[model samples]
Target: MTELLKLSGVHTHIGRYHILQGIDLVVPQGQTTMLLGRNGAGKTTTLRTIMGLWQASKGEISLAGMRIESRATPDIARLGVGYVPESMAVFSDLTVKENLVLAARDGPLDDAQLDWIFGFFPALRRFWLSRAGSLSGGQKQMLSIARAIIEPRKLLLIDEPTKGLAPAIVMALIECLKEIKRKGATILLVEQNFFAARELGDNVLVMDNGTIVHRGEMAALAADVPLQERLLGLSLEAHQ
Candidate 1:
């Protein structure tokens, strides 16, 4: 597969704190690469940096071989990159339809796009006219992801889509993300849910402190309990 996003020797600093240290990563086209790590590993920061939400203090970040390290956040987003933050970032005060309408860049909402989103998240369709603040956590997550894919995008940066969600909801999300991957979406995700990561990830990177320490096939990492214990310091078999 051709590389869609690449970060080479990337570093980020917030005030006096150096968070990312010589980080390097590659996101291939048409694949989901899971970024797994414990808290404070800079997973979220890496995603933010890719979206230009946080500037890289050093090194290179390129999307489809074009340099984007210095571009503004909105400009980077316009270059076919979509981001679904951990916070979900849905318009709580707006109706679901209105929220999606805003996500479509306030243009005419396409019926096909609405249909596509409904396929992944039936709840969104059911509550199209309901206020986004009234939806449950899982529904909000679905809406966040739906908005990110309202239009065709070359890459999607997703962070912790299943956090604090129930088991059934997590399973539903996993299935939905699998479908998204099948439709040729290139995704780089930060997830702590082992099951979701193991299921949706084609490739995996394990981070510790501030840099990635393990890079390999997701299946390989999933099958190796000792390695998981070493890197993640836990059995990658919980929450099943």
Candidate 2:
């Protein structure tokens, strides 16, 4: 598969804290790659840097063979990258349909795009006239992801999607993401949930203390209890 997004020797800092140290990652076209780690392992920072919310202090971020490291957030987003942050940052005052309109303006919204999101997230369609703040955590997450797909994107960066959601809701989100992958949107996901990561990821990169400690196929990592224990410092069975 052709590379859609590449981060080479990337370094980022927030204030006096040096969070990402020589980070490197590749998101191949038509595949879902997971960034796995314990909390505070820089997974969220990596996603933020790729979105240009945090500018890289060193190295390059290439999207479809073009350098985008110095580009502003909106510029980078316009270049076909959509980011769904952990907070599910929906406008509290706006109704769901109104928020969708804003997202449509940011990118082009055709009938097919609206249909696709509504098909994947039926709850979003049901609450189309509801205010964003009135929605549940899972509903907000669905809205956040739906807005990202308002335009056809070359890549999608999702950060901690399963956090603070009920299991049934998380499963629904995972299934929706799987459907998105089947439709050919390359994804780079930052997730701490082992079961969700193992389920959705084709490949996984385990980070510790701002550095990649292990990288391998998801199936292999899922089968290897010792590897999961050593890298994430937790047992997958315990998550069940």
* lDDT winner: 1
**Tens-digit per-residue lDDT, 145-234, candidate 2:** 888877778899999888888898788888988988898999999877777988899988888888788887888988999988988788
Error of 2 at 12 (Å): 0.8
Q: Estimate each model's TM-score.
A: 0.96, 0.94
Q: How well does model 1 score by local distance difference test?
A: 0.90
Any idea how many clashes model 1 has? 0
Clashing residue pair totals per candidate (backbone < 3 A): 0, 0
Model 2 clash pairs are none
TM-score of candidate 2 against the unseen true structure: 0.94
Q: Model 1: residues >4 Å from true position, as ranges?
A: none
